[model samples]
Target: MKKEIIIKHLGVVLLLNGVFLFISFLISFFLNESSTVALLFSALICGIFGVFPLIFVERTEHISFNEGLTIVVLGWIITCVVGMLPYLMWGGEFTLTNAWFESVSGFTTTGSTILTEIESLPKGILFWRSSTHWIGGIGVILFVLLILPRSKGQRITIYNTEISSLSKMNFRYNTRKIVHILAVVYISLTLLETIALMVFGMNFFDAINHSFATIATGGFSTKNLSIAEYNNLGIEVIIMVFMILSGNHFGLIYGTIMLKKENLFRSSLARTFVSVLLIGVLLVTLKLYLSGTYDLLTSLRYASFQVISLGTTTGFATVDTIHWPIFTQIILIYFTIQCAMSGSTSGGLKFDRVYIFFKLLGKQIKLLKHPNSVFVSKFDGKRIDEKLEEQTLVFIVLYVAVFFATTIILTAMDIDGMTAFSASIATLGNVGPGFENVSSLGNFASLPDFGKFVLSVNMLLGRLEIFNILALIMIKK
Candidate 1:
């Protein structure tokens, strides 16, 4: 297992995180926020640890899949450790546990928060929150892999760890090209959203921060009420459009931008993803209207917004859903579990997996009907390997099991069944927000410290993907 090589690669990740911290510090200083010292100190600490390895270790030409797995899993843990330092040092709603929880939430792009009053946070700290989304949106290692100028042969394996299987379908390009395409699309969308927000009268800083959150499908908002605080239909529509786009595979967005044949419009998986979301919106809207949760138009508006928000793994809230009917909440929770596409920023049991699961179901039914018949599962007519199908199924079971276990633990701690269950699935899916105590507008501040800690671990496990962490533990001696 080339431990030194893994350390060296990890050092690169630390350095990347340090750069972002430095940026946050400057923003803090300019804004005269109390978070400056925290950001500066965190940056220094990251720099010291990151650079020390460079002095002791030599560069390697390659890493094994095992080593890559170790670097990625450990890299995330280390990144979260480092990512929390500023909040810890700043000392507001951020005690050690709170900092770790928030940092994990940020880097995981879960957008689940523990703070009760987000607007009370300093601008620099808020920017740091949005920055975590930007960094984690693509992935910490991905940022390193994308910006760094070299190959270690295990690039695709690392990328697969960082992204998801479903996201890679549209990319026939080589590793470098794929990274380039992802970067271009990510940056372009962020810039475009920022411009749109600015035109809607957000200041440059708030617009940039909000754009970062939106493009990442991260629900961290400059305002406590999130995009709702804007009160502009234009802003909401712009956010919604981008949210839907960000929820799809970045590779497809790249294809469309590059004028490649396999664009978003052509991908059957993407079509189904949106179609399912629309249906969910329609259902939730009808339920809300029938129940008098809102007028017809208002119900549709909030329903579509909330549906897409959770559907994409973004956690922004215009209205608290804790009081919404159980049926509406169930629909939103379904989207939360079924997150956005693999190639994009959203995470969870990706729509691709759900699609694959149904296809695999049909394959099984066919096999039962014709015992000797060959049944090859397909996604968009591409043959889905038996191994991949098996792995996906295992992942889903593990995901549910973990969620259930976490829920049980929380329930034992006296958290309600609904809150515990929703929180468990929310963290397990890397989708932010839960019901009751941790609902759309509610925060996790009141959770027992140990419960918050457990959920943070769940967030990391989800963000890393279950198998990657498992593979990290099972590396051959």
Candidate 2:
């Protein structure tokens, strides 16, 4: 498995994480905050462990698929482990379990929080939290691939393991170009959002942190009320715009910006994703309005924002969704299951798979009626092969099974049915927030320790797209 090579690659990820931690330390130092020592110690630990591996291991020209998969999975685990250090050391509400949960949630871009009062955290710690999202958004391995020199074959191996097959369907470039495109698009969006938020009266610090969370679609807001605290339509609009864009495939975004033929407008999947989100918004808006939850304008605003936020798996909330009508809650839950496009930062059973599942269902119905006739499934004007179709179907079943199993476990722990089921879907989708107890404004602190750990696993499964972890388990077996 080239264990040394895997460790060496992980060292690079650790180095990158150390760089962010050092920056956070500087922030803490400047602010004279109590977290300064914690950040420094964490950074030092990362640097030491990170540099030691490089010293013992030499470079390899090629990495096998199994090796690459191991590195990606282990890299994320290591990143999350290191991520918890600062929180654990700082010593407030962060217990060992809480630190791990919050760290995993951040790196997975799940946006779920164990902290009851987010605003009480020090500025540096908060920045570190948001930084984890930005790093994890494109993936730690991807960022390392960009900066480090590696053979094309080696890069391709890791790239394939890290990114989903469905996501790669839109990319026509080599692995190197794909990495470049991701980096450029990610950085550009983050920078632009920071500026836009600053222009809209957000302070520079908050602007940058929120921009990191927004562009990453990670949903780790600096405020306790999330986007609701601002209550500024302009800021909300800007965030919503970025959230939508971030949920679409980054390759498509780059294509559109560069005026390429394969842009978002031309992509069928992209069109479907946007259309579904809009429909969700409309349905939820109507339900909210009819239920007398809010006036038309207010309902539209909040509904649009919440629907897009959860639909995109960004999870930024402008209102407490628990008080909303049951109809609206169901609509939101549907979006939580049918997440944004595959290539985007959003995770879960992607809309592409859901779209394919429906198309497959229709094909099955046609076959049932026509008995002797043949029917084929197609997407984006191309014929879908039976293998990919089968894979999609299996993925959906597995996704449902995992979430349902999680729900059962949580319920066995004495959690309410609604909280357990919604929490399962929310965590499994890597979409933060749930209904009833774990609603938009509520926190995960009330959940039992074992429940938090199970949800953390769910977050990892969602972010890694389930199969990767399954493949890892098979490899181990």
Candidate 3:
């Protein structure tokens, strides 16, 4: 590994974080909130650390996969750690564990919060909270890749760490162009979402925060009740639309925007993702109505929003799924696991793999019947290689195994089975909420420190996807 490159990239992270902290300080200064000292101090510390690395580490022209992997993984870990400084120092509902949980949740774009009162936070700190989503949504590595005047090869090395294989399908551009496209799509969506929310009766602060959340699929609403606080169908609809869009591959969004032939509209995986989500919504709506939970209109209202929210791994809630019928909860859980498309802000086992997984399964079945048949599983006429199939299958198994292990560990700590299972799946899926004790509108603050730490690791693993992590670990081995 190139230690200098790792330090240099880490330095860039510190600088980026410092910029946000300075913004927070300015907010506190203007508003005269108690956060001024803490935020400013944090900014100074980050800036000093950032500059120290710059002074010591010389510039490099390229980075190997090992350095890039280390930077991405360590960058996330450090980002969460540094992100907690303000929350840690400000000290309200933010206990050390709670602060870490909240920071990790934000940076992971998971949207889970320890605060019962979202409106209770200062504007500056709240903006910082939402900023974490924006920064983390595109990925810390991608952000560095975007800004650093780096070569395509150098960017590709880091891009490998930031985005999973499935997410890259539509990104035919070289690394530099891809970065430009990602930035444009990300910024445009955020700006548009903010404007839309503002038009629908949200204040500028809340609008910006929610937009940041939406475009990032990071769902940290300023109101504790989330989008329900507005009670505006128009607002919810706009948000749902963007949530789905943001959950999709940015490459597709760029392609569509640039009027390229290949885009979200062209991808089979995108179609399947939407179709599955639609079916999930329809099923949940029926269950809710039949169970007498809500009338048809009300059921569709909440069901559609909640399904899309979780399906995209956005996690904004109009209604808590925990109190819904068991059947409804199951449908919601499926969406959570399925997640959004690859190459977008949303995390977890992306829809691309899930779609391919079934196709691969069908090919296996046919191969079984035909004996000596040569079968090729294809996605949108693109032949899926045997190695790709094996990789996807391994990811699926590891994804389930990790969740199961987390559940077992949580249950051993005297938690209920349902809560443990849901919590495990929620964090592993990078979906914010779970059922029962960790339900929508609930927080992970109550978890034991060790449990919280374990869950945080799961969040990183899920966001980064399993193989990149394994690859990084195996590099040393």
Candidate 4:
């Protein structure tokens, strides 16, 4: 492994983070918030550390898979650590553990926060918080790769590490084009959402912040009540629309917008994803209405938003779902585990794997009836590779095992069963909020420090995908 290459690439990532931190510093300076010095010092620290590596390390044309894995994993750890500086320095509700938790949650786009009084923070700090989501939404390495003047081989190697294998299945483009498509789609959605929110009566700052959270599917709302603070139905509808779009494959969105041949309309998986979400909405809405929790119209509105929000892994809340029927909560939990599509901003056990898992099961059933018959599982008209199938199955099993273990740990830490289980799934799925204590409108301030650390690890595992971390460990060994 070329240690210098890894260091150099990580330096690039830090420099990119420095750029965002500098932007936040400017925001603080303009607003005259107390966080001005904090943001500036953080930016300088990033810049100094980032530049130091570049000063010594020479450019390389290629990186081995092991080196790429190291760079990606270590890069994320370094970025998360640096991201906490401003929060720590600002020092309101941010203790060392809380800062680390919030920072990891931000960069991983987990949306699980520890801030008890979110709105009490200054505008600059709040912008910095949302900026972490946007920066992390596409991934730190991806942003670095986009800007780095590197060999195609080097770019492709790192890109492979940054992007999920399942997400790459739909793309026909080369690595360069794939990178471009991701950036273009990400920026376009954020810009469009910002404009739409402003038109729907949100002020400029809040609109842009919400737009960042929405497009990234990060769910860091500017207000304490999340979308519920804005009682406008139009705003809710707009956010819901974008949340659903953001959950699907960004390449498909780009293709659809560009009138390409294989767009969302032509993709079977996209159709199924949307269809399942619609079914979830129907079930939840019906339960809410029948339970006399809300009128039909009100139930539809809240159910639709929460279902889509959590379904997409965005984690924004339009209502406190803790008070909802147990049936509706279970349905939402199903979506939380299923998560959004691959190639999207959202993370966790992607819906693609769930879809594949069911198809794989059906294939097995067919084979049982005729011993000599060969059954092939197909996705989007392509024969699924047996190797990929095995990996997906193992991934699902490992995902469940990890979260189950986490739930047990949290429960042993004296958290209630529901809260512990839901928290495990929420953080492991990179979906924010759980039932009971960590409800839709609730924060994660009450969990023990050890539990918070465990969940932070869960966030990284979900964001990086389980196999990458396992592969890294295996490679290191």
| lDDT: the better of candidates 3 and 4 | 4
Question: Clashing residue pairs, candidate 3?
Answer: 167-343
Candidate 2: worst 10 consecutive residues by lDDT?
Answer: 153-162
User: What do the candidate models score in CA lDDT, each in turn?
Assistant: 0.84, 0.87, 0.83, 0.88
User: Which residue pairs come into collision in candidate 2?
Assistant: none
> Tens digits of per-residue lDDT for model 3 on 156-232?
43355346555566777666777788888898999998998889888888898899999888889888788777889
Error of 1 at 228 (Å): 2.3
Every model's TM-score = 0.95, 0.96, 0.95, 0.96
Residue 198 miss distance in model 2 (angstroms): 1.0
Per-prediction RMSD in angstroms?
A: 2.2, 2.1, 2.1, 2.1
lDDT of 3: 0.83
* Model 4 Cα lDDT, one tens digit per residue, 1-477: 888898888898899889989999999899899999999999999999999999989987666667777888898899999999999999999999999999999988889999888889988889989998998997743563554344543534335434445556657876578788888889988999999999999999999999988888889988899999989999999999999999998888888999987689988889999999999999998999999999999999999999999999999998899878899999999999999988888889989899889999999898889879999988777887887788788989999999999999999999999999999999998899889999999999999999999999999999888878888889989
lDDT of 2 by residue, 293-366 (tens): 89999999999999999999999999999888888999999998888876777778878788788888999999
Per-residue lDDT of model 1, residues 166-217, tens digit only: 5566877776787788888889999999999889888999889988888888
